[model samples]
Target chain A: MQEELFAPGHRGCAGCGAAIAARLILKGSGKDVIIVSPTGCLEVISSPYPESAWKVPWIHSLFENAAAVASGVEVALKSLGRKDEAKVIVIGGDGATIDIGIGALSGMLERGHDITYICYDNEAYMNTGIQRSSSTPYGASTTTSPAGKVSFGENRPKKNLPAIAAAHGIPYVATASIAYPKDVIKKVKKAISIEGPKYLQIHAPCCTGWGFDGSKTIEIGRLAVETALFPIYESTEGKVTSVKKVKRKPVEEYLKAQRRFSHLFKIEGGEEELKKIQDIADSNAKQFGLDQ
Target chain B: MEIMEGSRAVAEAVKACRPNVIAAYPITPQTHIVEEIARMVADGELASEYVRVDSEHSAMSVCVGASATGARTYTATTSQGMALMHEVLFNAAGLRLPIVMTAANRSLSAPINIWNDQQDTVSERDSGWIQLYAEDTQEASDMIIQAYKIAEDHDILLPVMVGMDGFILTHVHEPVELCPQEKVDDFLPSYDPAYYLTPKNPLSFGTIVYPSTYTEFRYMIHEAMKRAERKIIDVASDFRDKFGRHYGGLIDTYEAEDAEVLIMAMGSVIGTAKDAVDELRSDGKKVGIVKVRCYRPFPAEAISEAVKNAKAIAVLDKNISLGYEGALYTDVKSALYNENGPLALGFILGLGGRDITKNTIKSIAEKAQKAIKSGRVEKDSEFVDVGVL
Candidate 1:
């Protein structure tokens, strides 16, 4: 009805998946919201001081404590008797959500605060240069986890943040992607309307860190969803009730677009690595009943 | 109106402060502070939001949010609870919100003992907060009032921590003159946060910053802390003028002039040191005491001057720096290095619930005096009274 809350002039790179994810989230949340963002690319680029691209009330706190900070905002508002005045939202990169900030996030979730936490999963720590994060998919090459002669790129499976959120038994928890713009917005809107802690992890491809064509951000996101690499679903109180499933496409369709996985195709690792990624997706699909 | 325990005095002061929100979890010695506040809120003695936060981290978080929304806020925690809040503590300071907190000083965990000590407050020294150490219940009550003033001051908008040594002062009841709400209101104006979550003016705080200017934002916090140094002195002076009790800036000295031996301490242990000084004085020992009221904005100038004339200085630290020396020992040694005055003795005492008895204090003073005379500083600081199995 009104112009989307995520205005233009944000310094996110051209076609950056996380930027697009942020914009999609803003569109879903609308303008009457206070956003608490953790220190990451979105915060750094959108708010460079003197001027900020965010048209909404936003706060950028430290990296490992955005959820805790958001809880503070919630407490402060509730104390001031302003809880219904505006919705409180938290946005951060994968590192902030999955690694360093996990404890803070757990505390917020355990408290059952009324807020929406959005994780723009760009795979690696793109803001501080492309270091490998726990969420970086197995066999993906990052600056910290280089693909060399006797080793696969990153050796660990991606952290299951959705499952972790579900374990908290929060009111609402979902996983979306930047590729499905309308769907991401729809899920985010649903999350905001929920009473207590709501979490949404959106799959956002990193163009710079992953070495991809900046113009193909949406296309990569779409491929990620179609190939079952990133599924869209929602869980309430640890019970999965709804999912957005699609016809499975080859993993190559998702991997070929990014150079971080380029080694898997070029070296002797592609098939094995692809199998590992497919296994992860397959397990997720089965757990959430995404394949109908 | 009547004599109250230090914890109860702090609790009453917070109640009268009229905080819109009070969120804190209870720990030993610190439990009574929050329990009283909660009871007051529940009985309608105070109209406030009292949150039984799961942890100290959540308690601080709730206060941060409430403060950002233009509500005056307060919380209390000690020892492990304080350590758990290390992350949020930095956030509150960086945001420049005037949320007041009371920390009942106690040692940290790992042979966890819930008793009186300064380890808890001392460990958080570098978190960019205005730290004040109180000697007695009256000072504790008065400091809470002034802490709000100093923290909410426009030039020094930062979180302020009021420290009372756990069981020693927190649970110890004493006479404290309660400042009427009218006086408190005059001393501390209604909190008008510079930045807040208001609809009339839509603004973003804590916005992300690029390397091009991120350093400057952090430096701004440092600048505000430095500004707090001068503001603290002015506020304390004004408070003394109004209340007739002088806290004497960041550093408060007691009978230091013309004394050859200077015993320096902080928190309620200064009370023990003062009694020790009295005993030594009656025996005609040239000894005096200096209490560090403000721990951060470290009071370097005031400390140097306090110990300038003393030939022997013994600094008592309630916290160990682990593998190094005590926290205050390092800071005091560094502060006195340029003056080349006082053969300094570092004594780590009352760590993890060990009581600092008058006899213990006298022994320390005697040892320190002998060390000064012999010119042999006790480089290996003692972790006083820690037992072995």
Candidate 2:
């Protein structure tokens, strides 16, 4: 077996999808990489002064500057005549990617830095106790966007970060899920192999925040892909090159497994809300050709 | 000596330091300095990687990353740009990256003025970076090289901010003797960090410190700043030995001994104050000047010793603390707290591009003399040279 760069003593919760993504990412990139993490769950859990689970070089600076930090590391290596030493990678959460850090991320992609930025999308601000983030799925209830008499949980659709990343005309962009560990590793390898900036958004479910059974993390992640609520695909130079085709599962299969969406089944006009969420899944399927 | 723009002189000094990476975002008054460095990088005169960042926050973040990776790094900004970089500044210092930045001092906004003032960097006094002020183009250029030596010292390993007044020093043209590259290379060697981000060593940086150890880390930074005071003086002495130029270590004095009155100030205002002191001495008024070169690691001991025998001391501040007195005035009072020291008074003037003339300093000195004769101060801190609308 390969040397485990992500050691076993981290403080991540049981069945944490982000922890699985972190282990698999290091496995794919090997030990010849420097990880730049922003302020998020993975950084806080993996590193807590005088102790770290990372057996490789890792740095956690702030919430909104991981891409900028990675750019500096990549250029510093080239300037020091050690460009072949290691690949630079950034592992940030969704709040650090689609929300506060989007400006720096866009700047990095525009500059064409030789770095791979992977954002583990846990949907909400899990580190800050399930606050609503731009990446929160539609009709899902979080602490900040609690469903009630006047509100329908998160009223807006998720931010299309992968498309925004590809719009920068980057070399590669892909989406993966922690349930498919092999695919996650494969995409990480391909991203590092590319010469310019590449972005990958991995759907990593949160068991605690999503109100699901700890053992059901991978099961729910697979449901997200199979139901077409979250499409898994690859785009190269702004064109869709490959996608994970699925025999379409009902959206209810994915929603019923998590308590965040359980309110919809009990609410007064929740069937109409359920139909709206189904339409969102249908839109994703049509756009990515996920139901081949 | 060759006549060069202050910005060009600074760029020349940075080239001599041989930094591995330079990241900067342009703002008013600071644009000329970075532009010259960028041009040199383009012309093949300097072989450093110049990353043009999108904002000042990223500019500092880029420096933090590069410096953590065992590379010498540099950046420059001012005023609102420095305000934008407040969070990253603390992070860089906490990580002990030893990055050097040029803060071309400019006034803060609300009225939105892009003119010369010391409020920008002064606002960041507690961010754990050594703060140095420059009185002229030559001193500003020379301090950049010295800043790197002081910051990269293993005993120190703290970031440094070399502050020069915007438009006053940044835009002025002066005859500056540019140090030869070989001499600078000898005085300041290549950066050899004890710890850095490298896959070969596999170390982590900027870890989250819990309550049990966070205070210890902060205390260590405080101790490092205390040690940096001595390093700053030693580096300046060595620089003077090699280059035949010396600005005093923490505080530079002019005719300060055996004087009845003393004036204290920093940055370009010191030049005007020096002329004012010369006039006062020739008139047999028994006055002198104390120029504060290093503002942080506040030279309280040196300041108290310098003004010990004097009856009254006047402090001129280009920046104010809004509701309170001038920041320097407050610090000067604190320095003189335990001693039977001079009756120190503060005068706020020359803010937001307002000129500080010789006459202004002479009048401030006259006010100090009056307080000495009265044996007490009428007003503690007063704003000088405010014309009624």
Candidate 3:
């Protein structure tokens, strides 16, 4: 109810997790924040020339330069003696954050600009119809990484962007899920309050791209956290300070809920692939102490 | 007047403009300018946020963001750096950011050349930014101040690139009368944009344009470019009135009115062409020089009017469009398509730092005279001073 900064009537699909994240993010940051978004699903759906869904100041430049753009906005405010007037934030997707925009993101983090960069991680490039991105999970079938007779699905593991972000020696880095609205809002508020660059990656599931019921978006996100496949945690200055621990559920429970992983139940040699995926989750749990 | 390197003069001029933010990635010949700016910022001579970006793409992107945020922004890069910024250049212009940049004109590379040529900026002619070429260090310094005035005009809210020959002008020492801070503050007032990214209004910028209205947006940009032609001229007139120095409006001419043949060029080569014209006149050759200062909004009418009485024209281009003739030659011919114009010939020279001496200008004049005597061109385009491999 916090002023509904991300207004309704946007073109986001029903039960869109990124749409929910955008609203929750603005709710926490309030009106005195400028948002910079690259070319992604949220940018396309929210801003259509003469119409806009955002009540806060926002800008969308190119597909891979949101961090750099936000850097400019932050520095401009500082230069104009209005640094305290607004907090600059960049809301980009996994593809824009982990792949094409990594250089600019690294630059922004390295330069220590007073901004918070948030990546709504829906795994694949959902804006371009589910092409495989660097953040796409292993064994998850996508448009570009379709499960085939000779291939299982995505061949590589999801890139550990939080760790990469923390490597910059930034003040804060956090990972959250869209299911935990309060947690997402809290982390955003906390990140913005810190001085230098802070990165927050939220696991926002895509019902349309992940081949699941639109109504099950939040449920699927919760499953991802519960199964320990997407560890929810916060690191302050390279040290893990807080984590969302859960009694671990089998990775199959999470994989079985989405059609992207439905192929694993039917295909030959898929059980072994499923075991490999469980090993990945186990490793993540061990790394972040996510298992209760 | 103070004697200083072209790069330092440009930095001094930029300091006087009082930009709110500056972002740039250093490339050869442009490095000295940004480095000088950084020195001034460290010395407290200028109070601007200098963001040292990793690449030229980010540099231009930073300018777009700052300019959209209602801050006057500046940046500079050249050659491969400019090529790397190709897409962002189009984005900045389309967004109507009115960010001013100095393009230390250098040749694009396959052989990896880092020398003076107009090819770098010439390739970006269609990117919707107003392009102005400078003939010397003084003009290059003066144009930076004029560029901001022209670009930040609400009626002509388009980005501008002030092109100076890389190394040739950027590295040379010359006596430049740097404008006083007070005078510049009067000539170019602080940038106050009508639309900007502000929390008070909370508006969105650079939104997605659908096919339903994309063409209309493009057409509006085109219309704005057309309007900027007059704005460029008027700003130049105002600059001359205030500063007591004049670099002609669209095309500056030296004795072109009654000449039998006209020599046309841009950038620092104009200085050499002027000396060549003086010599040609003393020898009764009846030749004059026409300097195309503003390349974009391509000053066709002014060019045609300048060379209307000439029997032939020789256009010296430091940039070639490959497969065809020089880019300026193509534009000049198209400009004269409907008029009883001169028999124009194209001469590509001085590319990749090849020196364009006074002798080169004299020989080009001889070619124009030959075309006049024959009442036709021997060849539409030819490379000047090519030696055997």
Candidate 4:
């Protein structure tokens, strides 16, 4: 592995989840990799050229076409007969991966191309100033999902993307978090080694959008996995292979650390909201077999 | 060595140039080009990755990915297909990938005319691509070969558009001198993108730009385009030196000397206009023509010089702006304005897939020549053929 593919002088804000995810991904994929990034925070801050944090070859196309661009890289390598020599990886925000770029990713996967798609889900569209995204969690407060008198933040649950990618029957699909660098890097390495299309969803919490301590980026992400709000698991061709069933903690341990959910605590009858959050976490735990 | 349609000629040229990746969808007029290439690939005549994308948008997207990964890529499309791939087109240009595509010029919606016209390519003029309009099959075949070399030039890394008229040039069979594989190989070097997505050089692409840095990035793109103007000419000159063919960059002139009036046109209309000029010359009428090759770069200087000595100039456009004059008319008018030159006239002709006959050109020349001799402006700028309608 190259010592520092994504060098240290990046301008990512404190506790920036996407930045951490990028570092782990680079470390996991090692030195021989091409990265296709969609328009997002990590892309904006890391590359303000003529000074870039990346030490390797990188390309930034558009907001909704990272997967397609990565596919181009794959085909180019195939033409050069270098598919085995270099791995092609596409990294984008959840908004770009699950929403705008979904069709391209689906087509690429259906075509059974040699590529890996890594989506760093920060929940909302943070780069555009905390706007609501399809991946924004239920009861999350964004600019568009304000917690007004009658509103309880977001009304929709986070879109289940891994399940969707798994439905494609791709060779590998997994979910990881920036909190666990080893876990995220391991999954990335596994996906890269796979022959066919692979997908990875990395949970990276945003400090500015989630109203959490910027320094708590890693700790909060760990709590997300530990509290069972976010599960760490991998699947191959619609079949579950492995899952990280950690020692579970109370859901409040995860919620109390973030300011975006602080309103739920401030309101009267806060116990009901807390119960709903717990119910959601319990369902995820039972579904993914995260609870022993 | 055999005669072929413009589409087949382009396909043959593409085969000779040897693209590593070909991704495209079937669209009218443009379909035959991709179909022929697919057949060649299937027959093992061309060694490439032929991707049959679900849509035009995907076709371009796949091409972008393939090209970025270090493959020589190609595709072709018509009106609606070009419009559908609009989003990816800008990306290809902005990323500065040397992608070569053939756009069979056709009319836009809502009537949905898929005949010969320039509306499709003109709509994408500002897409930051090297736009070239071919006068015939030979030019179409030849321009593509030059396009690859010009686009891949380190100083001018931009996508190139080689446009032929739908149904007219794309469908009609004509005798085009096909360049042999060795000649083409010698002419066009393998595509080597300046910036590639390679593992040895791990880098993050597509960063979000703030207002403070946005202007500078756009300025760099602009500067690259300005640099392309010189590089295109140099590439064309190099092609002429090596292949014994010349595009002369920006614009190609025909019989402009000692002429009272000049007809400015683009695409296949240049062929018709040239024939009309020769016939009129035999009839003792002083008429010549100037064909616009590079529309995006506008070629303001070339057009100005070609029409400077003429008493009158008429600009022909196959696209109408609706409630206003044609797109080319505005550009040509601005190029000739207050230049101490002849009066420039705007003629909205052959739009909506209307055919531009030699008689139409002869009549336009007669009327324009009379206006120039009289030293008086015509009653109208737009000269529509009501007689034909």
| Residue-wise C-alpha lDDT for candidate 4, range B38-95, written one tens digit per residue | 9999999999988777678878888888887778999999899999889789888877
Tens-place lDDT per residue, model 3, B1-389, is: 88899999999999999999999798998999999999999999999999999799899989988888889999999999999999999999899989999999999988899998889999999999999999999999999999999999989899999999999999999999999999999999999987988899999998999999999999988898999899999999999999999999988999887898898999999999999999999999999989999999899999999988999999999999999989999999999999989899999999999999999999989988988888889988999989888
Off by over 4 Å in 2: B387-389
Residue-level lDDT of model 1, residues B171-250, one tens digit each, is 98788888888888888878888878764566888765568887987899999998999988998999887778877788
**What is candidate 3's DockQ?**
0.83
Candidate 1 per-residue lDDT, tens place, A104-123, comes to 78888988889899999998
* Candidate 2 chain B: 10-residue stretch with minimal lDDT: B272-281
After superposition, the stretches of candidate 1 with alpha carbons farther than 4 Å from their true spots are A1-4, A143-157, A167-169, A236-241, A266-273, A279-292, B1-4, B26-29, B52-62, B109-113, B175-177, B208-219, B237-246, B304-311, B320-344, B367-389
Cα shift from native, residue B114, model 2 (Å): 0.5
The stretch of ten residues in a row with the least summed lDDT in candidate 4 chain B is: B200-209
What are the candidates' individual DockQ scores? 0.44, 0.83, 0.83, 0.51
Measured over the true interface residues after superposition, the C-alpha RMSD of each candidate is: 2.4, 0.7, 0.8, 2.2
lDDT of each: 0.84, 0.93, 0.94, 0.85
lDDT accuracy of residue A228 in candidate 1: 72
Alpha carbon lDDT at B18, candidate 1: 87
TM per candidate: 0.89, 0.99, 0.99, 0.92
